[model samples]
Target: MIIARILILLPLVSANKPQFPLGIAVYANPEFDICHRDMRAVMETRDLKFFNSVIDKTRIYSWPLKNFKSDIESLHNSPLFQLVRKMPKGAALHIHHKAMVNTDWLYLQTYRTNLYVCDKHNHLSLKFFKTPSNDCNWQALYERRRNPLVRQVLEDRIRRQMTMLTEIPDRSDTNVLWEKFQNIFTFLRSFLNYRPLAEDHFYQGLLELYEDNVMYVEVRSGLQKLYDLDGKIYTTTETVNILHDVVTRFKADHPDFIGAKIIYAKSRDMDHDELRSFLHETVELKKMFPGFIAGADLVGHEDAGYKLKDHSSLLLEVSNWTDFFFHAGETQNFLLQPTNLQIAIRHNAKRIGHAYSITKEPDTLRELKEKNIPVEVCPISNQVLGLVSNLRNHQAAILFALDIPVVISNDDPGLWGAKGLSDDFYMTLMSILPMNANLYSLKKIARNSIIYSTLSENEKAAALDSYEKRWQQFLINVTMPFCDYTQVMYSWLTLDRNTW
Candidate 1:
């Protein structure tokens, strides 16, 4: 009788024990549970097939590996990767506006009449006008690319100058890689910082994101001004207007697509005065285009730049109205003490970008848990930028295990030859996400993106409703090959919810 009582109580004890922290439920209605499970079943079966074929045979040259080189090598041609491309990713919340598109396109843009290039200190720079002085060392790119061999070399140089292709950046010298990374932007500025090209580039970037099945995106633009070829400068207001127009046009063409927003990011290396000026100007811009500028962020190498604490006063000046999208804990140097992350939490950041070291500090981790701040996890960016070596051991899995909400993003995807968010999503599922993380985890991640976005309440409701319809369609499409009439009818009934 005592043994029977113990067995009965054992079930109760296990029930109270914490299961995996699944974060917030995607839906309040329990009827959606059946829909989620069926969707999960299809995705899990597909995942198993992918693993059994590709992961089990990594010795084969065509498998997708963790690092940038191996992954990029197989990414373009893989059938499984194509499936990832088709999957409906809800939102991409952490892309840099400038680095949204690849450099190859920028190289082609330089050919748009009379563009001069100079080779200074072995670094390529571009200018719109020709300089008569030989001392200027400016040569026309069009003239230089006339010869076949020279053209090949010139294009190759341009590609290398704008991408992180050669080096494998690790913790020992991330600064070196960062220097190269920043220089790429400087090199491409003349080509991309012009008005017409800027509009085209931004639109093309959105096209790529849309093609990858990403419905919504929030890009981090530094609110820099654009210039024309005739040295005519466009103000920040004009730039913002151009961005708005581009997104509006894209949405018009793709009616089913949700909208995009901008997070006006600024360099942390700026002095106090510059920070104050930026805030003032951004506030004015926000007044002009209320919905266009969603929030503000500090964008730079987290290790070398000033921590958020240094600019607290200036930051607090606009904290009441302007939401903070702090890029904190993106470094390995401060493992023992994550000052950046701690300051971000203190400031009550809406969302933390690349909180790579948050897991180290227990107090900060707990605070983040209680506050429910989502970490924008850029797994490929971390690997390529030298923050983490292997995705298999990335701290994101630990954060996820602890119920910390994470949204996978493609940071600087273009620089690394990643076409869209699909690359990051594929990498997350195959490498970073734990073995037990299933389609429901993916569903939650997608849901968290909208839940944490700067969109208004009504917009959120509309977006979620639209997403549900798309998800239902996606389920039918993905499971079509594996399902027969009975399974199809069951899925339809589950989606109909009223039947229950």
Candidate 2:
């Protein structure tokens, strides 16, 4: 009787054991398991090739274990990156409007007619001038680029100034790095904000994402007034309408494209009255273009900006009018009083941007998990901005381990010459996530992007349906030619389609 009882308990315990560890991978189906095994083999083969080719053989082989700008070329050449580029990312929830297009493309716009450049206080500014002005010693860009030698030198200088790439990425101070980062946007604003160029820029930005297999995007736009070379200015309302028209035109051309939305953003350093005025304007815009305007956010360097708690009353008052997707906890200082994460949660933000320091606050992490608020993880942006030296040490890895919701995003991809979500996804997979992470991990993160979006319930359902079809096709395309027929059939037989 004792032997029989022990045998009975043994099977029960064995049956209760989990097939995989807790976290996003736990959701993997048998079909994904088969595909994952194949992907891993390819990854290992490609990685070994990369390791052998490194000039210093003594250096360890770790893809994306270095600075993003430094490794971008190699990443572009990577087979894994090609695979990720083809993967259907549901939505990009944390991109900024100003830096959406590649800098190289924006630089080409400088060659257009009627554009002028000015040098004042050792700062460069571009503007559309009807006639030349002596204010700040303005010169026509057309004339400057007339000589081939001068144009080549000018292009090189402008390209370097427009990007944060450097041979030595470790800046003496984080503040210095941020100054350079902001300065890039300030210089590019003139090119991007021009009326005709702005329209094309927005369209091309959408096309860039579409080509990379991303179906939807929510842009954090300041809605800065648009200007023309002809000297006419567009109001904020008109700017909103122009963006909507752009989306309409884009969707008409690409029917499968889900569309784009704007998160009206303002500098977090605004005084109370200034913030209030922006908030009221945001509310009116949302009312005017409910579908196009997803919500609002306060964007700037978190360390130097006003705390969310300082203007909590005003933020809370407008919560009903528009969703809040505040940028909180992007700093290294996790111990600051009234942490931005805490205040953002208290104010009911639809999603938290970055949350880089959340690992230090277990209580806040638990609250975010419990509340089901997904944090937009911009791994490259964090590394580029001096937040983390290596992608492996990023906090999103910890969050993913605990099964917290995370949506990978390219915060300002264009600034770094990264075109779409692929590079960020590649960095997350190669370094930030566990070695065992595979297609299922990508699937879960992709699903979270759509599920956590500000899209309507009906829209979410349609997007998911579309994502499923695309996902099925992707799996078949990537696995069928390489996978064993019998094994593929067996995995397909056991797959629970509803679970995904």
Number of the top lDDT candidate: 2
Would you estimate the TM-scores of all the predictions?
0.87, 0.89
Query: Clashes in model 1: which pairs?
Result: none
Model 1 C-alpha lDDT per residue in residues 385-456, reported as the tens digit of each score: 887767777899888778787888898998888878888887776676665444444656776788788889
TM accuracy, model 2: 0.89
* Count: clashes, candidate 1: 0
The top-ranked prediction according to TM-score is 2
Worst 10 residues of 1 by lDDT: 6-15
Q: Which tens-of-lDDT digit does each residue in 290-336 have in candidate 2?
A: 88998899989987856888888998889888889999999998767
